[model samples]
Target chain A: MYKLELKRLIKSRSTLFLAAAMLGMSVFFACVTVAGAGSMESRGYITLRGMEAIEYQRGLFAEVEGYVTTERLEEMSDYSVWARDTYGRADNMPRDVYERWISYEPILSGSCGRMSCEADEYYAERRAALARLAPSEAAIASALALNWRVDEPFYWEYGFGGSEAGVNWTLCLFALCLFCTVIAVPAFSQGYSCGADGILRCARLGRGKLARAKILAVYSVCGALYLLSAALFCAVILLTFGPDGSSAQLKLGAFVLLDMSMTGVLALCVLSGLITMLASVSFTLWLSSLLPNGVHVLALSAVMLALPSFVNAYMSYPACDWLRLLLPTGSTGLQIGMYNELAAYRFLTLGPAAIWTPFAALAVPALEAPAFALLARRAYVRHEGA
Target chain B: MNIEIQNLTKKFGKKTAVDSVSLTLTPGVWGLIGANGAGKTTLMRMLVGILTPTSGRVLCDGADTREMGEAWRDMLGYLPQSFGYYPEFSVADYLDYMAALKGLEKKAARRKIAELCEILSLTRVYKNKIKKLSGGTQRRVGIAQAMLNDPRVLILDEPTSGLDPGERVRFRNLLSEFARGRIVLISTHIVSDVEYIAAENAVMKAGRIIDAGTTAELLRAVEGRVFTARIPERELERAESAVRVVSLKNEGGGETLVRYVAEGPLLPGSDFAEPRLEDLYLWLFRDERRQDDV
Candidate 1:
């Protein structure tokens, strides 16, 4: 039955078209990103490859540390000279001074050697907030503490620069969600729509085997789409940009990507994306059982997949913080970086608390996939010919 | 096996579709004849175990189908009134897909499908897509799928609905062949389908089985009650309004031959005619026909 269902799925022309379209979209965007990076690199703005990026940052950080002095800060503090030479002009300042100033901002701010009352209060709030974390979240926070990098100079690389990786990973996940929705939206409902559900429900394999086969087929298709799209996107970006940042610290990639290896951040992002894919497929199957028409399921699922991509722009409220993280759309955002933000909650005893946004994002889908699968199975069994 | 329906009833809110329908049968074709809305479909659906009954049970070989679940389903073969097909699939592929759903292994399914294709004379069109096939051919495919597993209990609802007369005859012969050891329940509005093949006839009226017996026994209800007369063509409407006209034929200019079922002859020159399953069905469902006219 599983083999037959797979054959039927592969034979569907529309499904094939949709799969190809998903891959095409990913490849097209990847080519455009690479070309844009090449154009920027030609204009004396060099982007480092993976290992070269790590070596360049290590070299720059060491040089910057040598010049992180009170006298340099005093000179930089001189308004007339600073404004005349380096205020808004990019080419006037020496590269070493600029790198030191940018990379050691935190150290320079605390270099006065006296802790202000405001800083004291901030530390107290951070410690109190850290104490409020769940056991799992606290464990994660402790793990992160063990590998924390104090300060690292940013690496400007072809594929890893600006919002390149964030945008690429985001689109890769969004495309995966689309592929799953298109494939699974019609999974259960097509039987009903085509009027085959009645004959199937009464056959020997109809009771449980048929419904199980459909779900398994849907999962197989979704899993393939995720792997193909992720691999294609990763290959294109890494090949074009050169995999220089694999050994680089997460703090170098983004200000808040803290305490993790760059590769670890990439892996977690992909894992979070895959979790949401599972959740999307399971939820669509459940919805297909409930909805009367297959086309309606398709339409609603497309909306569910697309609407979440825009959620991060408008969603901001303390009350809705947990609600936002638990949504399927929230998982598609740059949750890898968002997990490290400590601005929202603070603990006086334990210092700043690590956010559990990505963990919650992963957990919601991990829990929802099975729950929806059960609901869908019950619906299929209880379904009459009508 | 024996199928015993001990006081089965199914109701949809305020309306009852099958009311206290009961029967016991084994190893023969039992034709359930009824008019539209006479509960033939509801009864068949319940027997197939797809719809839950409002009351009562259907026991196959003393095991209630509701409790037996898949075990009962395995013994059953059903072709619903309107079976759906995947339009893109060829006839062979459609049958193969159904065979998989029926849990037939590839080699066994191929053999069964080959045998049925010969029996149904569907060999030539086996490679044709279902959407392009004629309605009668599609119906034959439905019949072919129902017989795939050689079920112990076969239930067909309006099995001969869309077949041509020639196809209908062929289907009836096939049904007769298949009914040797299995219990076959065929529900249809076409009375001739039951005329030659049905071993026992169950007549449905409203939501109840008003009568059940051999074809000869069922015809006994209208014995000496069916009459034919030569009437003026202008008086056909009056005859139609006043009596149950089973059929009408043009005899000559300004005259018509009217065959009808009634308590007595309406015309003095009317002569008695042999009662058939048609007359029996018309006589049984006359009240609903009158309601339809109103």
Candidate 2:
């Protein structure tokens, strides 16, 4: 029965069109991000070969690296006096002269001081939640230590500030969820729309086994779409960017300050994306079974998957911010941010174990997928031909 | 197996579609004859367990349909009044899909599907999509799916509605051949389809069975009430308004032969005519319309 349903799904014109549209969107974004990659004029450290060109500047700013420590933050107060004595506050300085001056010791020291100050303020804002998450505090400190790109200069355009590849991945995953919803929401109601539900319900194995078959078919379609889209997106990014810093720490890039390996961070992104896709499809299937009209299911699913993104972007409640990140449409940056240095919030504690914000976020979909599948099955079996 | 409908009733909001009625179906071809909005489809839907009855239950072998939902369906086959099919599916694929729904094994389903297609004269168009088929051919495919499981209790609603004259005759013959031991209830607008083949005939009006018996018995009930008369062309309207005209024929210049159902002669020179199922149908509904008007 599942095989037959899958065949029917793939053969449907609507499903085919949605699948093609999803792939097209993913390819378009990935291509655009790769083609217009990093600029050679930008200042943040990127690749090993790039560091060769700026070795003289790095040696000149060696004194600022020692002052980036947490204990010496007060000693760094003399950097403003030093900047005034060297490059005076002149109105019209040449662009090249200003750029070279900023690459000196005083400017680098001031930038590191500003980063530390911002970290302290963020920690203060989330003190209560941070008190519970000791490991998260440690991870955040480690991420800060590895955050500066003082040596390496290989520009990975896939990072946050480089070419916006991370944002594209997030958008592609979200669009994939929408496409999977379009494919899944009509599985139970196809018969209803065409006047075949009565006949189907009356068939010997239809009322019971057929419901299970439809659920399996929906999940199978969702999984296939995710795998295909994710693989295509990854191939395009990796091939164009040349996987230079994959083994390097995630902090090696200009954005995404984390204490973990680059591979581990990418894995978490993929895991979160797959979980969100599954949860969204299962929840939409349940909605389909509960409602009578296909349009209602589609509309309600749109609201469910989209409303969370809008709320996450606009709403700012520190106490419940971790909970918001647990939503299926939660921000991808937030997932990385949960593991980044200075992520001091710990919204949950299980006995002696401290569940950090990232793990808490992962726990949501881990529990939601099975629960949604069970509810969808129950709704379908109990459904009458209304 | 036997199906007993005990006090079956169904309602759609303020309108009662199938009223409190009871029926016992055994192994034979039972013809259900009714006009539009006569509740034949509603009763059939209830019997098949697709629509829940407002009161009472349908029992198969002493078990309620609601209690034995899947098991009850396992022994039954039904074709709805408005039969639907996936337009993208070919005739063979549609049959195979239905076979899977009915829990038939693959080898058995293939064999059964092949036999049905051949029996229904659909072998040549087996691979053709249903949307591309003609109305008569599509109806044949509907019939093929209904008989896939060789169900013990088979119900078909308006199975001959789209068939041509020759196809209708062929389908009627096929139904007769398939109804040897299984119980088959066919509801249709074509009276002659039931007049010759069905062992028993039932007539419904306003959600209730007004009359039921063999065709000969129903004809006998309205016997001596049917008459034929000759009238002038100009007076034909007056004759029609006075009573029910079952049929009208144009004789030569200005003369007409009118076969009508009436208790007494409407013309000075009239002859008694034999009553058929059509005559009985017109008389029953015509009488009900008159009462509604009053």
Candidate 3:
């Protein structure tokens, strides 16, 4: 029975069309990420984009790729000050001097501009910021304790600017969620619309066994779609950027809270996106069981998928933020999703504990998927047709 | 197998669809005759356990069918008045799918599908999509799916609406042979479909079983009242407005032959005629037809 149900789902024209669209979007977004990449020569002349920019930057930063030690930080600071004093700006220096000296300035300056500070000052400031942001003393201690896992010297390497690919992947995940909605919204409601339920509900196994088969098939198809598209996107980006920066710390500056490597961050983002897809599909199936028309389910599912992004964009209240994080497709948004939350200091305070937003985002949907799936089964089994 | 419908009633809001109906069904072919909206479909849906009744219960061998659950459904086959199939499935695929839902093993399903396809003349279109088939052929496929499990209690609603005369004859023959020891309940307004094969018949009107008995017994209600008369062609319209005309035939030479049902001889030269189930149907639903015409 399960095999037959799976065959029925796979043979549908709409399912096939949406699956093809997902695969096509994966390649298209990967290409967009690569095409938008840009880099400049050490002399600040002869800028390049696309693969040329990637290849040039890879060689320019190769020698300085190990770790950012205190001595290296002081040497970068001394060169930056000398270049500014001699030529008024680092970009105006001679090409050889800028290539060997000023090329590492972006990594040193980062976003906070405090990357070149003394080791003691940097650690003290990070601790103070964490203490101010943490909900309680225990939370502050936990936040500071998390810093011990950071690589001691902080590895530095040319990442081919992989963050561009990461941003595009977030948008790709949003599109995949919509495509999954289209595929799953009709799993049970089509039977009501087309009059198939009249005969189906009379079959010996139609009540429970058939509902289980349909739910399993829908999950299998959606999961496979997410895995395949994600792999394609990752392959295209990794092939173009190479794996040179897999161990580079994501926390490029003192303010960024996460201490994982770039590769680990990417893996977490992909896992969260997959969970968000499953949760959205499960909710859509439950709606399908309750509603009698597929179009209505599709409309409702699409609205729910977009609601989190809209709330995150136009609302600033703390409750609104919690609402955004708790929605089924919460972590697939481009503006305030799992990928961005990992780099920020956002946390959810519960009594005397502070839970990070990234963990809450992943945990909520993991529980929702099974809960909605059970609701869907119950609705289908108890359904009475006209 | 025995199915006793005890005081079955179903209501939608304030309007009652099946009102306090009761019947006991045993092993034989039974016919449920009614006009449109006489609660035949509602009664059949309740019997299948898809629609819950308002104030009654269905018993299978003295056990409540609701408690029986899947066990009750296991011995049943049903074809609704109108049904649809998944657009992607071919005829063979649909039958195979239904067989699996009916809990037939793979080899047994394949064998039964082949046998039913031959019996229903669907071999040539086995691989064709159901939506592409003719209406009559689609109805035949519906019948095939209902019989795949060889159910002990088979219920079919309006099973012969789209069938031509030849196909109807074949269907009647099929049911006659399949109804030897099983309970086959067929609900239809076309009385001839069950006139010859039914061992017992029930007549419904306005959501109630007004009459029920053997065909010979049901026909007795309109036996002496049915008559045939010869009248002038010009008077045919006036005669139709005065009495219930079951049929009319022009004999040429300005004379027409009319077969009608009435209390007594209301024409110049009227003769008694042998009665069939159709005469009783028209006689019983005369007021309904009047309301429909108005």
Per-residue accuracy of model 3 over B1-294 as CA lDDT, tens digit each: 788989999898887888899899888999999888888999998898888888899999999988888888888899988867887889999999999999999999999999999999999999999999999999999999999999999999989989999989999999999998899999987888889789999998878899999999989899899999999998988999888888899998999999998888787699999998888988898778422200
Q: Write the per-residue lDDT of candidate 2 for residues A57-81, one digit (tens) a residue.
A: 3343334332233333333334434
- Those runs of model 1 whose alpha carbons end farther than 4 Å from true positions after fitting are A38-88, A93-163, A244-259, A306-315, A327-330, A333-355, B289-294
Best by TM-score: 3
Q: Tens digits of per-residue lDDT for model 3 on A222-299? A: 999989999998888889887544333323235445566666666777899889999999999999999998889999
Model 2 agreement with the true structure over B1-294: per-residue lDDT tens digits: 788889899888888878887888888899998778888988998898877789989888898988997888888888887778766788988898899999999999999999988888999999999889998898898888889998888999989988999889989898898999899999987888887789998888888888888888888877998999988999998999988998899998899999998878877578999899889988887855422100
- Candidate 1 per-residue C-alpha lDDT over B175-203 given as tens digits, one digit per residue, 9 for 90 to 100: 99989998899988788888889999898
Distance from true position, residue B228, model 1, in Å?
Answer: 1.1
Sort by DockQ, best first: what order?
A: 3, 1, 2
TM-score of chain A of each: 0.69, 0.67, 0.92
Question: In order, what DockQ does each candidate have?
Answer: 0.67, 0.58, 0.77
Model 2, native contacts kept: 0.66
Best by DockQ: 3
Which CAPRI quality tier does the interface of model 3 achieve?
Answer: medium
Q: What is the lDDT of residue A99 in candidate 2?
A: 42
Which digits, one per residue and each the tens of the lDDT, describe model 1 over residues A166-269?
Answer: 55666657766777778888777877888777788889888678888888888887788777876787677666554534222222322232444354455666
Candidate with more favorable, higher DockQ: 2 or 3 = 3
